[model samples]
Target: MTAVIDKKKCNGCGLCALYCPLDVIYMEDGIGHVVYPDECWHCGACRQECAKGAVRFEFGAMMLAV
Candidate 1:
């Protein structure tokens, strides 16, 4: 499983990047995104920390519905 970044909902706040304990998130083109999907430990930290409701998880072909 991995975290997903919704481009439409993201405001480039960097909250996820700031909150991530693993330093997994970053900004590109003024958008918050995941840098290392494989490095994710599925801790659900970023998903819960995202204030704008932009971060979520995807397990295989099924995404965890927010």
Candidate 2:
């Protein structure tokens, strides 16, 4: 799954970058961006931690159940 960030909703909190287990997310010009999408574990930690709901999943909703 890909973690997509909405620049409109993103407040540049950097939480997604900080909390990502794989250390894939990073802040670029105060915007959250994924650096290593192929390593994503779909753990939903980024989505869950984003208070503004800026981070989202492109697929694998069922994997979140586990």
Candidate 3:
């Protein structure tokens, strides 16, 4: 899955970049962006930490069964 950043929602918080285990996300023009969307491992760590909900899945996600 690819991670998508909503330019309008991004606040340049740097949370995605910090939480990214593969270092795929980064900041640009005071906004957060996925530098390497293909490198994302679908770990969902960034999605949980992002306050703005800027990062999203492009291919849709499964509802993890509890």
Candidate 4:
């Protein structure tokens, strides 16, 4: 899984970065970015903490299969 931040919806609150348990998200130029997608635990903490609802998770095709 990977976290994708929508720039239009993001308000640069940095909450997503702060809430990421694995430190996968980072703040740059007042915007939250997924710097380490490979390290993501798919815990959804960042998405839950984002007040603007700018953070979203994208699962690979392989991951979608049960």
Candidate 5:
């Protein structure tokens, strides 16, 4: 599984980047982007910490419904 960043919902607050323990998430051009998806620990820190609910888990062909 990998974390997906919603471009529409993301305000580029860098909260996910700050919350990510593995330093996988980063801000680029005022947007949240993943630097290394494989490095994700799946600890759900980025997803849970995002108050805007922009970050989500992508599992195969399905995405976590909030």
Candidate 6:
């Protein structure tokens, strides 16, 4: 899974970056950016912590298989 932030919806609250356990998110120009996507644990912390609901998870085809 990958975390994607919508720049239009993001309020630049920085909560996503703060809540990321692996420090995958970083703040730049007051916006949360996924700087280390490879390090993300797919824990959903960033998405959950986003008050504006800017963060979303994108699952790959392999993860969608049942």
Per-residue CA lDDT of model 4 for 1-66, tens digit only, reads 788999889989988888888999889988988988889988989899988989888987778995
Estimate TM-scores for all models: 0.81, 0.83, 0.83, 0.86, 0.84, 0.84
What is candidate 3's CA lDDT for residue 62? 48
Error of 3 at 47 (Å): 0.8
Task: Output the better candidate (1/3) by TM-score.
Answer: 3
Model 5: lowest-lDDT 10 consecutive positions: 57-66
What is the per-residue lDDT of model 2 for residues 1-66, given as tens digits with 9 covering 90 to 100? 788889999999999988999998989898898888878888899999999999887865665777
Question: Best TM-score goes to which candidate?
Answer: 4
Give the local distance difference test score of model 3. Answer: 0.84
Per-prediction backbone clash count: 0, 0, 0, 0, 0, 0
C-alpha local distance difference test of each model: 0.84, 0.88, 0.84, 0.88, 0.88, 0.87
TM-score of 2: 0.83
Q: Where is the poorest 10-residue window by lDDT in model 1?
A: 57-66
- How many times do residue backbones clash in model 2? 0
**lDDT (10s digit) by residue, model 1, range 1-66:** 888999999988887888888888888898888989878888878888788899888785445553
Worst 10 residues of 2 by lDDT: 57-66
* TM-score-superior candidate, 3 or 6: 6
Provide the lDDT at 10 for model 2. Answer: 96
Error of 6 at 66 (Å): 12
